[model samples]
Target: MPTHYEGSKKERIALDSFIKFMRASESVTSKLAHGLADYNLTMSQFGTLEVLYHLGPMCQKAIGEKLLKSGGNITMVVNNLEDRGLVSRKRRESDRRFVSVALTEEGTALIEEVLPHHVELIVEMFGVLSDDEQQRMGEFCKRIGLAAASEEES
Candidate 1:
Protein backbone atom coordinates (compact mmCIF):
# COMPACT_ATOMS: atom_id res chain seq x y z
CA MET A 1 0.00 0.00 0.00
CA PRO A 2 1.30 3.46 -0.94
CA THR A 3 0.47 6.80 0.68
CA HIS A 4 -2.11 8.55 -1.45
CA TYR A 5 -0.85 12.06 -2.22
CA GLU A 6 -3.84 12.38 -4.49
CA GLY A 7 -4.62 16.08 -4.69
CA SER A 8 -3.03 18.37 -7.24
CA LYS A 9 0.36 19.62 -6.06
CA LYS A 10 -0.87 23.21 -6.42
CA GLU A 11 -3.73 22.62 -3.98
CA ARG A 12 -1.40 21.09 -1.41
CA ILE A 13 1.03 23.97 -1.73
CA ALA A 14 -1.78 26.51 -1.35
CA LEU A 15 -3.12 24.77 1.75
CA ASP A 16 0.30 24.63 3.35
CA SER A 17 0.87 28.29 2.59
CA PHE A 18 -2.50 29.26 4.06
CA ILE A 19 -1.81 27.34 7.27
CA LYS A 20 1.48 29.17 7.71
CA PHE A 21 -0.21 32.48 7.00
CA MET A 22 -2.86 31.88 9.65
CA ARG A 23 -0.25 30.92 12.23
CA ALA A 24 1.77 34.03 11.53
CA SER A 25 -1.36 36.17 11.82
CA GLU A 26 -2.25 34.68 15.16
CA SER A 27 1.26 35.14 16.51
CA VAL A 28 1.51 38.71 15.30
CA THR A 29 -1.86 39.66 16.72
CA SER A 30 -0.90 38.27 20.10
CA LYS A 31 2.34 40.22 20.05
CA LEU A 32 0.50 43.37 19.04
CA ALA A 33 -1.91 42.97 21.94
CA HIS A 34 0.98 42.63 24.35
CA GLY A 35 2.72 45.64 22.80
CA LEU A 36 -0.36 47.80 23.32
CA ALA A 37 0.11 47.51 27.05
CA ASP A 38 2.68 50.28 26.86
CA TYR A 39 -0.12 52.59 25.80
CA ASN A 40 -2.56 51.16 28.33
CA LEU A 41 -4.92 50.00 25.60
CA THR A 42 -6.39 46.55 25.27
CA MET A 43 -6.89 45.14 21.79
CA SER A 44 -10.63 45.73 21.87
CA GLN A 45 -10.26 49.25 23.21
CA PHE A 46 -7.67 50.11 20.60
CA GLY A 47 -9.90 48.73 17.87
CA THR A 48 -12.87 50.76 19.06
CA LEU A 49 -10.83 53.94 19.24
CA GLU A 50 -9.38 53.35 15.79
CA VAL A 51 -12.83 52.93 14.33
CA LEU A 52 -14.10 56.09 15.96
CA TYR A 53 -11.09 58.05 14.80
CA HIS A 54 -11.52 56.98 11.20
CA LEU A 55 -15.33 57.15 10.95
CA GLY A 56 -15.96 60.25 13.03
CA PRO A 57 -19.03 60.49 15.20
CA MET A 58 -21.47 57.62 14.72
CA CYS A 59 -24.41 56.18 16.59
CA GLN A 60 -23.55 53.52 19.17
CA LYS A 61 -25.45 51.01 17.06
CA ALA A 62 -23.39 51.91 14.03
CA ILE A 63 -20.15 51.31 15.82
CA GLY A 64 -21.32 47.89 16.90
CA GLU A 65 -22.23 47.06 13.32
CA LYS A 66 -18.89 48.21 11.97
CA LEU A 67 -16.98 46.27 14.61
CA LEU A 68 -19.00 43.11 14.01
CA LYS A 69 -19.68 43.10 17.74
CA SER A 70 -22.86 42.99 19.75
CA GLY A 71 -24.44 46.09 21.26
CA GLY A 72 -23.57 44.82 24.77
CA ASN A 73 -19.96 44.35 23.76
CA ILE A 74 -19.78 47.83 22.27
CA THR A 75 -21.31 49.24 25.39
CA MET A 76 -18.58 47.68 27.53
CA VAL A 77 -15.85 48.97 25.23
CA VAL A 78 -17.40 52.41 25.18
CA ASN A 79 -17.68 52.41 28.94
CA ASN A 80 -13.99 51.57 29.31
CA LEU A 81 -12.96 54.24 26.82
CA GLU A 82 -15.20 56.67 28.61
CA ASP A 83 -13.64 55.83 31.97
CA ARG A 84 -10.29 56.68 30.44
CA GLY A 85 -11.70 59.91 29.04
CA LEU A 86 -10.96 58.68 25.58
CA VAL A 87 -14.48 58.73 24.18
CA SER A 88 -17.75 60.48 24.77
CA ARG A 89 -21.32 59.57 23.97
CA LYS A 90 -23.79 62.25 23.04
CA ARG A 91 -27.48 61.95 22.47
CA ARG A 92 -28.46 62.55 18.88
CA GLU A 93 -30.34 65.81 18.46
CA SER A 94 -32.91 64.49 16.04
CA ASP A 95 -33.80 61.41 18.03
CA ARG A 96 -33.21 61.05 21.71
CA ARG A 97 -33.29 57.30 21.23
CA PHE A 98 -29.95 57.27 19.43
CA VAL A 99 -26.58 58.10 20.86
CA SER A 100 -23.47 59.14 18.95
CA VAL A 101 -19.95 58.09 19.87
CA ALA A 102 -16.92 60.26 19.27
CA LEU A 103 -13.34 60.11 20.34
CA THR A 104 -12.18 62.71 22.76
CA GLU A 105 -9.03 64.75 22.24
CA GLU A 106 -7.14 62.19 24.29
CA GLY A 107 -8.41 59.28 22.24
CA THR A 108 -7.52 61.02 18.98
CA ALA A 109 -4.01 61.69 20.18
CA LEU A 110 -3.60 58.19 21.52
CA ILE A 111 -4.65 56.49 18.30
CA GLU A 112 -2.62 58.91 16.19
CA GLU A 113 0.54 58.04 18.04
CA VAL A 114 -0.17 54.32 18.19
CA LEU A 115 -1.26 53.83 14.56
CA PRO A 116 2.16 54.50 13.03
CA HIS A 117 3.78 51.97 15.32
CA HIS A 118 1.03 49.47 14.54
CA VAL A 119 1.63 49.85 10.83
CA GLU A 120 5.37 49.64 11.31
CA LEU A 121 4.97 46.47 13.37
CA ILE A 122 2.87 44.85 10.66
CA VAL A 123 5.34 45.88 7.99
CA GLU A 124 8.31 44.72 9.95
CA MET A 125 6.72 41.34 10.56
CA PHE A 126 5.38 40.61 7.06
CA GLY A 127 7.44 42.96 4.90
CA VAL A 128 9.85 40.07 4.37
CA LEU A 129 7.54 39.03 1.55
CA SER A 130 7.95 40.72 -1.82
CA ASP A 131 5.16 42.93 -3.15
CA ASP A 132 3.96 40.31 -5.60
CA GLU A 133 3.91 37.62 -2.93
CA GLN A 134 1.98 39.88 -0.58
CA GLN A 135 -0.57 40.67 -3.26
CA ARG A 136 -1.04 37.03 -4.07
CA MET A 137 -1.41 36.16 -0.42
CA GLY A 138 -4.00 38.89 0.00
CA GLU A 139 -6.02 37.60 -2.94
CA PHE A 140 -5.85 34.07 -1.67
CA CYS A 141 -7.02 35.03 1.81
CA LYS A 142 -9.80 37.26 0.51
CA ARG A 143 -11.09 34.51 -1.74
CA ILE A 144 -11.02 32.01 1.08
CA GLY A 145 -12.83 34.33 3.46
CA LEU A 146 -15.45 35.24 0.87
CA ALA A 147 -16.03 31.61 0.05
CA ALA A 148 -16.48 30.72 3.68
CA ALA A 149 -18.87 33.61 4.25
CA SER A 150 -20.87 32.78 1.16
CA GLU A 151 -21.37 29.24 2.40
CA GLU A 152 -23.40 30.62 5.29
CA GLU A 153 -25.81 32.27 2.86
CA SER A 154 -26.36 29.06 0.98
Candidate 2:
Protein backbone atom coordinates (compact mmCIF):
# COMPACT_ATOMS: atom_id res chain seq x y z
CA MET A 1 0.00 0.00 0.00
CA PRO A 2 1.15 3.53 -0.71
CA THR A 3 1.43 6.19 1.97
CA HIS A 4 -1.85 7.88 2.90
CA TYR A 5 -0.13 10.91 4.40
CA GLU A 6 -2.04 13.71 2.63
CA GLY A 7 1.19 15.55 2.01
CA SER A 8 2.99 17.12 -0.91
CA LYS A 9 3.80 14.97 -3.97
CA LYS A 10 7.48 14.83 -3.08
CA GLU A 11 6.71 13.70 0.45
CA ARG A 12 4.28 11.07 -0.73
CA ILE A 13 6.66 9.68 -3.32
CA ALA A 14 9.56 9.47 -0.87
CA LEU A 15 7.38 7.84 1.78
CA ASP A 16 5.99 5.35 -0.69
CA SER A 17 9.46 4.42 -1.96
CA PHE A 18 10.75 4.03 1.59
CA ILE A 19 7.82 1.77 2.43
CA LYS A 20 8.43 -0.42 -0.59
CA PHE A 21 12.16 -0.60 0.15
CA MET A 22 11.55 -1.63 3.76
CA ARG A 23 8.95 -4.23 2.85
CA ALA A 24 11.20 -5.79 0.22
CA SER A 25 14.10 -5.85 2.65
CA GLU A 26 12.02 -7.51 5.32
CA SER A 27 10.57 -10.09 2.95
CA VAL A 28 14.00 -11.07 1.62
CA THR A 29 15.48 -11.23 5.10
CA SER A 30 12.63 -13.38 6.36
CA LYS A 31 12.98 -15.81 3.49
CA LEU A 32 16.70 -16.21 4.12
CA ALA A 33 16.27 -16.47 7.87
CA HIS A 34 13.74 -19.24 7.43
CA GLY A 35 16.56 -21.55 6.33
CA LEU A 36 18.39 -21.08 9.65
CA ALA A 37 15.81 -23.19 11.42
CA ASP A 38 17.28 -26.30 9.83
CA TYR A 39 20.34 -25.63 11.97
CA ASN A 40 18.32 -24.63 15.04
CA LEU A 41 19.54 -21.04 14.94
CA THR A 42 17.68 -17.79 15.31
CA MET A 43 18.45 -15.03 12.82
CA SER A 44 20.72 -13.31 15.33
CA GLN A 45 22.56 -16.52 16.09
CA PHE A 46 23.18 -17.25 12.44
CA GLY A 47 24.29 -13.68 11.81
CA THR A 48 26.74 -13.92 14.69
CA LEU A 49 28.15 -17.17 13.46
CA GLU A 50 28.39 -15.90 9.90
CA VAL A 51 30.27 -12.81 11.05
CA LEU A 52 32.69 -14.80 13.13
CA TYR A 53 33.08 -17.26 10.33
CA HIS A 54 34.00 -14.61 7.79
CA LEU A 55 35.84 -12.11 9.99
CA GLY A 56 37.70 -14.36 12.38
CA PRO A 57 37.73 -13.83 16.13
CA MET A 58 36.36 -10.49 17.33
CA CYS A 59 35.49 -8.92 20.65
CA GLN A 60 31.90 -9.32 21.80
CA LYS A 61 31.28 -5.61 21.31
CA ALA A 62 32.58 -5.74 17.74
CA ILE A 63 30.27 -8.65 17.00
CA GLY A 64 27.37 -6.62 18.36
CA GLU A 65 28.33 -3.66 16.20
CA LYS A 66 28.75 -5.78 13.10
CA LEU A 67 25.36 -7.38 13.61
CA LEU A 68 23.72 -4.12 14.75
CA LYS A 69 22.61 -5.98 17.81
CA SER A 70 22.24 -4.66 21.35
CA GLY A 71 24.86 -5.63 23.92
CA GLY A 72 22.44 -7.69 25.99
CA ASN A 73 21.11 -9.46 22.95
CA ILE A 74 24.61 -10.24 21.66
CA THR A 75 25.58 -11.51 25.08
CA MET A 76 22.60 -13.84 25.17
CA VAL A 77 23.27 -15.07 21.65
CA VAL A 78 26.91 -15.69 22.49
CA ASN A 79 25.98 -17.44 25.71
CA ASN A 80 23.53 -19.66 23.91
CA LEU A 81 26.03 -20.60 21.21
CA GLU A 82 28.70 -21.14 23.82
CA ASP A 83 26.37 -23.42 25.73
CA ARG A 84 25.96 -25.39 22.56
CA GLY A 85 29.77 -25.62 22.18
CA LEU A 86 29.57 -23.71 18.91
CA VAL A 87 31.51 -20.70 20.16
CA SER A 88 34.04 -19.90 22.82
CA ARG A 89 35.07 -16.66 24.49
CA LYS A 90 38.44 -15.63 25.84
CA ARG A 91 39.21 -12.65 28.02
CA ARG A 92 41.86 -10.27 26.87
CA GLU A 93 44.87 -10.58 29.14
CA SER A 94 45.48 -6.83 28.93
CA ASP A 95 41.83 -5.95 29.52
CA ARG A 96 39.67 -8.45 31.30
CA ARG A 97 36.65 -6.41 30.39
CA PHE A 98 37.10 -7.23 26.71
CA VAL A 99 36.33 -10.71 25.58
CA SER A 100 36.82 -12.08 22.07
CA VAL A 101 34.40 -14.55 20.59
CA ALA A 102 35.48 -17.22 18.14
CA LEU A 103 33.86 -20.11 16.47
CA THR A 104 34.78 -23.50 17.77
CA GLU A 105 35.51 -26.40 15.46
CA GLU A 106 31.83 -27.17 15.54
CA GLY A 107 30.90 -23.58 14.87
CA THR A 108 33.24 -23.41 11.90
CA ALA A 109 31.77 -26.59 10.52
CA LEU A 110 28.23 -25.40 10.97
CA ILE A 111 28.73 -22.03 9.31
CA GLU A 112 30.59 -23.62 6.44
CA GLU A 113 27.58 -25.83 5.97
CA VAL A 114 25.01 -23.07 6.33
CA LEU A 115 26.73 -20.37 4.29
CA PRO A 116 26.45 -22.06 0.92
CA HIS A 117 22.72 -22.51 1.22
CA HIS A 118 22.27 -18.95 2.50
CA VAL A 119 24.26 -17.62 -0.43
CA GLU A 120 22.28 -19.73 -2.87
CA LEU A 121 19.07 -18.22 -1.54
CA ILE A 122 20.43 -14.72 -2.06
CA VAL A 123 21.52 -15.58 -5.58
CA GLU A 124 18.11 -16.97 -6.32
CA MET A 125 16.41 -13.83 -5.09
CA PHE A 126 18.65 -11.56 -7.10
CA GLY A 127 18.31 -13.79 -10.14
CA VAL A 128 15.07 -12.01 -10.92
CA LEU A 129 17.11 -8.97 -11.86
CA SER A 130 19.25 -8.77 -14.96
CA ASP A 131 22.97 -8.47 -14.27
CA ASP A 132 22.99 -4.77 -15.10
CA GLU A 133 19.88 -4.09 -13.07
CA GLN A 134 21.36 -5.91 -10.10
CA GLN A 135 24.49 -3.81 -10.32
CA ARG A 136 22.49 -0.60 -10.50
CA MET A 137 20.30 -1.65 -7.62
CA GLY A 138 23.34 -2.40 -5.48
CA GLU A 139 24.76 1.04 -6.21
CA PHE A 140 21.45 2.70 -5.44
CA CYS A 141 21.07 0.87 -2.16
CA LYS A 142 24.58 1.78 -1.06
CA ARG A 143 24.03 5.40 -1.96
CA ILE A 144 20.77 5.46 -0.06
CA GLY A 145 22.37 3.97 3.02
CA LEU A 146 25.27 6.39 2.95
CA ALA A 147 22.98 9.34 2.45
CA ALA A 148 20.85 8.22 5.37
CA ALA A 149 23.95 7.92 7.54
CA SER A 150 24.99 11.45 6.63
CA GLU A 151 21.50 12.72 7.34
CA GLU A 152 21.60 11.11 10.76
CA GLU A 153 24.90 12.81 11.54
CA SER A 154 23.59 16.23 10.64
Candidate 3:
Protein backbone atom coordinates (compact mmCIF):
# COMPACT_ATOMS: atom_id res chain seq x y z
CA MET A 1 0.00 0.00 0.00
CA PRO A 2 1.39 3.40 -1.00
CA THR A 3 0.59 5.78 1.79
CA HIS A 4 1.78 8.97 0.18
CA TYR A 5 3.40 11.40 2.59
CA GLU A 6 2.51 14.18 0.20
CA GLY A 7 -0.06 14.04 -2.55
CA SER A 8 2.29 14.83 -5.41
CA LYS A 9 4.12 13.00 -8.17
CA LYS A 10 7.41 14.63 -7.13
CA GLU A 11 7.07 13.09 -3.67
CA ARG A 12 6.77 9.64 -5.20
CA ILE A 13 9.85 10.19 -7.31
CA ALA A 14 11.81 11.50 -4.36
CA LEU A 15 10.82 8.54 -2.20
CA ASP A 16 11.80 6.08 -4.90
CA SER A 17 15.14 7.82 -5.44
CA PHE A 18 15.88 7.73 -1.71
CA ILE A 19 15.19 4.01 -1.52
CA LYS A 20 17.42 3.34 -4.53
CA PHE A 21 20.21 5.40 -3.04
CA MET A 22 20.02 3.49 0.23
CA ARG A 23 20.05 0.16 -1.55
CA ALA A 24 23.06 1.16 -3.63
CA SER A 25 24.95 2.28 -0.55
CA GLU A 26 24.25 -1.03 1.17
CA SER A 27 25.36 -2.93 -1.90
CA VAL A 28 28.63 -1.04 -2.12
CA THR A 29 29.37 -1.67 1.55
CA SER A 30 28.66 -5.36 1.13
CA LYS A 31 30.98 -5.51 -1.83
CA LEU A 32 33.72 -3.83 0.15
CA ALA A 33 33.17 -6.31 2.96
CA HIS A 34 33.55 -9.17 0.50
CA GLY A 35 36.73 -7.65 -0.90
CA LEU A 36 38.22 -7.47 2.56
CA ALA A 37 37.02 -10.93 3.62
CA ASP A 38 40.01 -12.57 1.95
CA TYR A 39 42.24 -10.65 4.32
CA ASN A 40 40.68 -12.32 7.36
CA LEU A 41 39.02 -9.19 8.67
CA THR A 42 35.39 -8.39 9.36
CA MET A 43 33.87 -4.94 9.01
CA SER A 44 33.90 -4.42 12.77
CA GLN A 45 37.57 -5.38 13.00
CA PHE A 46 38.45 -3.09 10.15
CA GLY A 47 36.61 -0.27 11.83
CA THR A 48 38.41 -0.92 15.12
CA LEU A 49 41.79 -0.93 13.40
CA GLU A 50 40.94 2.19 11.47
CA VAL A 51 39.97 4.01 14.65
CA LEU A 52 43.10 2.97 16.47
CA TYR A 53 45.28 3.89 13.54
CA HIS A 54 43.89 7.38 13.22
CA LEU A 55 42.90 8.19 16.78
CA GLY A 56 45.88 6.67 18.59
CA PRO A 57 45.43 4.62 21.76
CA MET A 58 41.93 4.23 23.17
CA CYS A 59 40.54 2.10 25.95
CA GLN A 60 38.70 -1.09 25.02
CA LYS A 61 35.51 0.00 26.79
CA ALA A 62 35.53 3.30 24.94
CA ILE A 63 36.21 1.54 21.65
CA GLY A 64 33.28 -0.79 22.37
CA GLU A 65 31.04 2.23 22.88
CA LYS A 66 32.31 3.69 19.62
CA LEU A 67 31.54 0.43 17.80
CA LEU A 68 28.17 0.14 19.55
CA LYS A 69 29.12 -3.40 20.49
CA SER A 70 29.18 -5.18 23.84
CA GLY A 71 32.34 -5.44 25.92
CA GLY A 72 32.68 -9.10 24.93
CA ASN A 73 32.52 -8.24 21.27
CA ILE A 74 35.25 -5.63 21.70
CA THR A 75 37.37 -8.19 23.54
CA MET A 76 36.98 -10.65 20.72
CA VAL A 77 37.91 -8.01 18.16
CA VAL A 78 40.94 -7.00 20.18
CA ASN A 79 42.02 -10.59 20.48
CA ASN A 80 41.77 -11.08 16.74
CA LEU A 81 43.75 -7.91 16.08
CA GLU A 82 46.32 -9.02 18.59
CA ASP A 83 46.67 -12.42 16.97
CA ARG A 84 47.16 -10.72 13.62
CA GLY A 85 49.80 -8.46 15.21
CA LEU A 86 47.84 -5.53 13.84
CA VAL A 87 47.16 -4.01 17.21
CA SER A 88 48.54 -4.19 20.73
CA ARG A 89 46.82 -3.88 24.08
CA LYS A 90 48.61 -2.50 27.09
CA ARG A 91 47.53 -2.06 30.66
CA ARG A 92 47.07 1.55 31.68
CA GLU A 93 49.77 2.71 34.03
CA SER A 94 47.22 4.24 36.35
CA ASP A 95 44.87 1.31 36.30
CA ARG A 96 45.90 -2.28 35.66
CA ARG A 97 42.32 -3.34 34.90
CA PHE A 98 42.06 -0.81 32.07
CA VAL A 99 43.54 -1.87 28.75
CA SER A 100 44.36 0.59 26.00
CA VAL A 101 44.38 -0.60 22.42
CA ALA A 102 46.72 0.92 19.87
CA LEU A 103 47.46 0.04 16.32
CA THR A 104 50.82 -1.55 15.70
CA GLU A 105 52.99 -0.32 12.83
CA GLU A 106 51.70 -3.29 10.90
CA GLY A 107 48.12 -2.20 11.45
CA THR A 108 48.87 1.33 10.33
CA ALA A 109 50.49 0.08 7.16
CA LEU A 110 47.63 -2.34 6.55
CA ILE A 111 44.99 0.39 6.82
CA GLU A 112 47.02 2.66 4.58
CA GLU A 113 47.16 -0.09 1.99
CA VAL A 114 43.51 -1.06 2.27
CA LEU A 115 42.09 2.46 2.34
CA PRO A 116 43.11 3.44 -1.18
CA HIS A 117 41.69 0.26 -2.69
CA HIS A 118 38.45 0.67 -0.77
CA VAL A 119 38.18 4.29 -1.88
CA GLU A 120 38.93 3.37 -5.46
CA LEU A 121 36.15 0.81 -5.40
CA ILE A 122 33.70 3.37 -4.05
CA VAL A 123 34.75 5.81 -6.74
CA GLU A 124 34.26 3.19 -9.41
CA MET A 125 30.79 2.55 -8.01
CA PHE A 126 30.01 6.26 -8.42
CA GLY A 127 31.97 6.77 -11.62
CA VAL A 128 28.84 7.62 -13.52
CA LEU A 129 28.35 10.73 -11.40
CA SER A 130 29.91 13.92 -12.70
CA ASP A 131 32.54 15.59 -10.52
CA ASP A 132 30.09 18.29 -9.45
CA GLU A 133 27.48 15.70 -8.60
CA GLN A 134 30.03 13.69 -6.66
CA GLN A 135 31.05 16.70 -4.59
CA ARG A 136 27.45 17.61 -3.91
CA MET A 137 26.64 14.03 -3.01
CA GLY A 138 29.53 13.90 -0.59
CA GLU A 139 28.39 17.11 1.06
CA PHE A 140 24.84 15.80 1.26
CA CYS A 141 26.03 12.58 2.86
CA LYS A 142 28.07 14.51 5.44
CA ARG A 143 25.07 16.63 6.32
CA ILE A 144 22.86 13.59 6.70
CA GLY A 145 25.45 11.83 8.85
CA LEU A 146 25.83 14.84 11.14
CA ALA A 147 22.09 15.17 11.44
CA ALA A 148 21.73 11.50 12.29
CA ALA A 149 24.49 11.76 14.90
CA SER A 150 22.81 14.77 16.45
CA GLU A 151 19.49 12.99 16.58
CA GLU A 152 21.13 9.96 18.18
CA GLU A 153 22.73 12.14 20.81
CA SER A 154 19.35 13.58 21.71
TM-score of each: 0.85, 0.91, 0.75
* Candidate 2 lDDT by residue in tens digits, 1-154: 5567878988898898899999999999889878888889999999999999989999988999999989999999999999999999998788888888999999999999999998899999999999999999999999999998999989
Q: Which ten residues in a row have the lowest lDDT in candidate 2?
A: 1-10
- Candidate 3: list runs displaced more than 4 Å: 1-11, 65-72, 94-97, 146-154
Question: Which candidate would rank higher by lDDT, 2 or 3?
Answer: 2
- The whole-model lDDT of each prediction reads 0.86, 0.92, 0.85
lDDT of 1 by residue, 62-96 (tens): 88888789999889999999999999999989998
Which pairs of residues collide in model 3?
Answer: none
Which of 1 and 3 is the better model by TM-score?
1
Per-residue lDDT over 20-130 for candidate 3, one digit per residue giving the tens place of the 0 to 100 score: 778888998899898778677898898898788778899998888888899999899999999999999899999898888999899989988887877787778888899
List candidate 1 segments past 4 Å from native: 1-18
